[model samples]
Target: MNAWLDDWDGNIARTKGVCWIAGWDGDAMGLNQAGPSIRCGSLGEWNPDERMTRLVLIGTDIDENRVSDTLDRCLVRADEEGTSWNPERGPFPRR
Candidate 1:
């Protein structure tokens, strides 16, 4: 999670007209390019662990498939033991 944020911050200058909403363990962070405002809060009072991340991006001239592919690579895959696992390294492509 920390690594993802770091990469986003590092490349923020190159992004435009987009919004990102990420949730983890019931907590969520929101950022919009319109005003570049950042907001964070629990999804609800009765927070429960979903153990998943959700991101929503809206903008012009963006390739939906590419964005989907990029985010898909960050997801955890099921191992032989039936446990979800993320890669040791971040999946975001390097600039």
Candidate 2:
């Protein structure tokens, strides 16, 4: 399975309510979009061993500590996303 990530934008309603992340499970049936978009829960929940990344939305006004905790709770693996691309048209880079 694949992992999808999302962020919380600075929305007025969001400030008062819980923040939610959305993504494509690459499966949930829908219109033209090829991914399943959900709220706070993640598609990553389906794959316990999979690795997922989180990108904080720029406008979010929450504290950094809260963000870190959220990432730890949400990301599939606890490291940074793989940087750099394959030297050749080869496999994905290592984390």
Candidate 3:
């Protein structure tokens, strides 16, 4: 699919819920800034914003679905399936 700008009130810094997952096998969705939640202080360092870098994990990976479900709980959406996601806009809009 092509890149889209859904105009989400200028939130470039993607928090947990605001991020989407794009992987090799048809990209999963709802993967927060920290992919698949890990234990506290376990997900090692990475070069955020600059590029996508993998963090060093000390423990077994958490269930990605659990993380996705958790994100769903926090997300505020008008859609029922929680499929509606808004991307950031470019160059700002005119009032």
Which window of 10 residues has the lowest lDDT sum in candidate 1? 16-25
In candidate 3, how many Å is residue 95 off?
Answer: 34
What is candidate 1's lDDT per residue for 3-85, written digit by digit as tens? 43343432233332222223232333332332243333333322244433455554556666766676565554555233432
Clashing pairs in 2: 24-36, 25-36
Candidate lDDT values, in order = 0.38, 0.32, 0.29
> How many collisions per candidate?
0, 2, 1
Judged by lDDT relative to the true structure, which candidate is superior, 2 or 3? Answer: 2
Highest-scoring model, TM-score: 1
RMSD of each: 8.1, 14.2, 14.1
Between candidates 2 and 3, the TM-score winner? 2
lDDT of 3 by residue, 25-54 (tens): 122222233333211111232234533323
Q: Let me know the TM-score candidate 3 reaches against the reference structure.
A: 0.22
lDDT of 2 by residue, 1-95 (tens): 01222444233122211222223332221111112333332222334344233333333355767756765665434353353322244221211
Score residue 15 of candidate 3 by CA lDDT.
27
Q: Which candidate leads in lDDT? A: 1
In candidate 3, which residue pairs get closer than 3 Å at backbone N, Cα or C atoms, i.e. clash? Answer: 23-27
Displacement of residue 22 (Cα, Å) in model 2 is 14
